[model samples]
Target chain A: MASSYSIILAILAAAAAGLVGAFALMKRTILAGDVMSHIAIPGLGLALLFAWDPLVGGGLTLFLGILIIWQLQKKTELSAEAAIGVIFASSVALGALLIHSDEALVDALFGGFKNLTPAEFAFGAGASILIIVALWLLRNKLIISLFSPELAISSGINVDRINLWYLLLFGLAILANLRFLGALLVGSLIIIPAAVSRQLTHSLGTFLTTSVIVSVLSMLIGTFIAMHYNLDTGATVVVTAAAFFVLSLFKKKR
Target chain B: MQPALTVLNIEVSFDGKNVLEDVSMELGAGESLAVIGPNGAGKTVFLRALLGMIPYRGTITWAPKTRIGYVPQKIDADRHLPVNFKNLFAAKASILKLPAADIEEVIEIVGLNNNIITTSVGHLSGGEFQRGLIAFALLGKPSVLIFDEPTASIDVAGEEQIYDLIHRLQDAQGITTIVVSHDLSFVYQYATKVLCLNRAGVCFGEPDIALTPEALEKLYGPHKYFHYFNDSHSDDHRTKNHDIQQ
Candidate 1:
């Protein structure tokens, strides 16, 4: 039996993921974002080992991963995908070695929908709202910067600073959903909905809106299916989102 | 009156290798300056330095209140991107906190119609896309227009139209123009001054006076100079001098 609070939080997080995913897809960083989530695995494993709050540990390492990726790109002049790929492989290995218990590892890898306490709901919902609002405010800058960094620089926008902000917000979005979606599949929610929406829409506004709709639909449907069949919520939600993407491929892009 | 721009002994390097060295030039207000060079001659790098997009050693100065509008050579945009010209214009306008009327004015100036503005950027033709970029640069009413090969992607006929449009914009607005061009004819037609670069300032002055046969030969290796002029003009001797004022 899923609590209404848990469902509400999940829905809000889905909307946030949808918005973030739209920008990620447009920036061609969707795959990089998937790998970015893996950096949180080692943190989750450490928290389990030490009996600390798992989300707190995940948040710290995710923040470190974000900074490392940003600095790697800046210093090495490597593309974001390449920089993230380097960090992702090491973080996954470290996480695998740290988590000694199989059951805890499964719980960390494929998240379950547990009853949400008021504090957890408040924190998760607050993070979701923060991501959504920050993205909305930064959308115009992000649009121009992603289109052309040279043009954005000439237009008086601080492109590097904007990129850093985007990376931070992207990490926050992942952290907000890490408890429910887990590291393995959380990035899929952020990648698949926007992909589906991209196939269907041809304008920025439509693309963002449709992505949010698809993400929310996936969350709701996946939750129901999970509760009914006693299946994993995170895996089911990601699969549902992937299903939407496959169906969207059938619609001829105009 | 003060000069519109001045670059003094500018030097840019990457990985300890100097891409541009001892490059210097000046442009007066309402003047059109053409930067000519062979491939990898640091022409684009010079433009980036001028725009303050990259760091360089020497001083590059623009007069106070000098707002620059830049049209880059090419945009490697994703073809399936959902953004249209209108969306890009609106985004720039919003970032600059400009009024909607400003967008309409630029659209009219660049001769972009509603259909073109509504179409996705990747879908627009080469000429239409170039016009859209020019229109984007026109926003915020910049005092200087900097173009990096404005017609690189355009066809032969479209190149002429783009040049004419740039020439017209200069005449109508009296804005300072700095263009990096490969077309010798364009330099003679529109530029008030020309700076020939080959890792350094090889020559700087009016087209006919500074671009001597010897200078052209030095800037573009002798073989390339002969081939370029011979392919375009009828006589080799006349091509050497290239009396473009005709």
Candidate 2:
């Protein structure tokens, strides 16, 4: 059995990753986050290729993903959605090719959840706290930017700077959650909670608060279920979060 | 005191077709200017250009430090989207960081009660939505307010209320107001200046001097049915005046 400290550490890591994902979804930039998550795959392959840690590889991969997406969005005629789609498809293909040639595909796909060292836990927890605090301080500006960027500009809010910060924080969150949730499900964790919360509240503050609560609860419950049933933790967490989303929809309908 | 706004050598074209050319006009502050012309006379384009929503090649400058507010001819907001007055007001204030009380003050000035604050904009009658737009524009306490055919989709009663609201806002705030309208009778009652436009701006002055029959004939030509109707109405009044004098 995993130590009590380890379980707590895992829950904390999941919550942090979930919160970052939630923030991205709230801002309606989930496509960007999804692209960054996929780009981490090639990084995982390269990390395994060099006998380096996958988390480090994943972080570097996610950073490159962000750079490609940002540059394409600014420079290309393609809309933000199309840019993300192109990057996402290409990154996934490249990652698949790298995995086929260098590392066992199962290892990359299942991720390194069983090998969560105490050091990685600490790193994830620290990164998550930093991202959450940054989002909190800029919540007001972020909401305004999301709703109407032109109005935000006239009001003296530097929208470009805020979008840059959001991208940076999103990259870091995807990087931190790579080991615990794998790169594939990390995007879902970010999107599902916030989307569920959106149906429950109209106020921005309420939506964010409820998103955090739902994320934390899903992590804890999913972790417990995984432990009892001896199931894969990452899959179990996402499934549980999905369950919560479905529950929110029903409750909202009532 | 040099007219509130000056538009000189303004030219706007869409896809190589000229919408307006060499359109020029000057309006004074605390004065009401009514722009009247047939359809496709670039009335909406002129208003949008003033708001900086479209790109135009010419010099159009307002009086120094003039805060300008605009109400579009129509807001094509999606009916499916659940937008309400509070949501709309909050969306704007979410940028300015203005307190709730400030939003409420503008809503009250527009004569919209608390019911409008919570009701969905999709469900509001055209009159209510127009008032909401006016309230949204006025929330900034602009020095100049421009309305582009605000009463186009509303009933006569709604138009009267809108006109009254416009006058009320002008009187209360001393704002320089410009309205683009086809309602000549309404303009006669409220406007201090008139700007007549076609593919090019034709005249800009007091309505009595600017809206001469000759000028109307030149701008509208065969489309002077409404102008003649107004002329006959005025002739009847003149005849009655002569009879009274006798």
Candidate 3:
């Protein structure tokens, strides 16, 4: 029953991450996920330090990380990826310094699902639904902004404001998924499923729907196999997502 | 009646270096103006200043609430992104807050076939892609249309056809047209007035009076001017293309 609760949380987190992942993949910011995931490790360390829930700790820490990256990118001459790289390296060192024990490091990297509670499961469901609905409402504007910034400006859309909001949504999805997927595997959860969907679909609508379906399936299969074989669930989910991406590559697109 | 657009002593500097200086012109309603110059001639900077995409020290006064449509020379699209004609048009239509028209109507306005809207933007032929851009510009229904090197990356025949289409569209709508072009042949054939620009306004008048051998020499310098003029260099097809028809 406890494992089932954790599984549900995993599914919700995967769904949220994979949905936004579709757009990020198109924007060529797929590596930003890897960067964010590594940086959120320090957030996990802070959660243990404060005796609060890891989700709260990680989300707040990653939020600060996002802000730093955004401001540095704007105020300095550094590129966006370069700004993220600086934060990622600093956070990794900080996370290492803060972690007390081998078990704590393992939990930070791979999430101790055994520690999850019923309340955490509920929180996962609510946050996932909220993120998905928000993305749905903003879909049209996001699509337009992603296509052409000049067209966005000419049509009266404030492109900069939309991009900031997009970054917020991206950071939120990444932090929320860091629980079950862990800081290491969460980035793959977002990228691989969306990438597989990209190869199979022609239109934007199909692209989004297919990515969600693939995310859910990968989580279900990976969790079941890992539970049965007594393997690391986080690693299994990532491997499962990779398997899907491989199958997708074989399927001819265009 | 007051002119459609008036400029007085336009100056643009980047990092304290002058890119364009003391440019002035007055364009009447429905008049077509072509801005011609060689590389580093500040043609794009001038166009950007006119579009209000950049800043300059100048008084650029337009008639009140004048709507303008701009078609860029080209857009580089990523093949990984999902961009089609209908969605692209829908984005602009939503911005305009106008009801979306049938694909056929838009294609007809821009002289394209109905089936092309579903194709990815990167896959379209050069001419068809340019028409697609013009169709998007028309979504705003502006009184003035600006083209930035419309015939670039197109074959000679394709360039001629595109210019011909522009002429027909301008006349039919009585649209005020402004084109930035390097093709002197097209300027001679279609421009009502020309502005020869190189860091400053070299000359501004009807093509016949402004584009004389002296002005050509001044724009291109003596060595390059000899090939363009003096009837010695037969290899210049644009000039030969002009001669063959005359």
Q: Model 2 interface RMSD, in angstroms?
A: 5.0
**The best candidate in terms of TM-score:** 1
- Candidate 1 C-alpha RMSD relative to the actual structure: 5.0
Root-mean-square deviation (CA) per prediction: 5.0, 8.7, 5.1
Docking class of 3: acceptable
The lDDT, on a scale of 0 to 1, for candidate 3 is 0.76
Q: Can you tell me which runs of candidate 1 are displaced by over 4 Å?
A: A75-83, B230-246
RMSD of 2: 8.7
Using lDDT as the measure, the top candidate is 1
What's the CA error at residue B90 for candidate 2, in Å? 5.9
Stretches of candidate 2 exceeding 4 Å from the true structure: A1-33, A46-83, A100-127, A130-169, A252-254, B12-21, B33-48, B53-55, B70-101, B113-115, B118-133, B146-159, B178-246
lDDT on C-alpha atoms for all candidate structures: 0.86, 0.73, 0.76
Clashes of 3: 0
Candidate 2 lDDT tens digits, B36-139: 77778999888878876668999999888887777766544433223366766776676566788889899888889878667655567778878887887776
Between candidates 1 and 3, which one is better according to DockQ?
1
lDDT by residue (B120-238, candidate 1, tens digit) is 77777778988999999999999999999887766667778889989988899998999998888888889999999999999998888988998998998876776665453222122
| Residue B180 lDDT, candidate 1, scale 0-100 | 91
Q: List the residue pairs that clash in candidate 1.
A: none
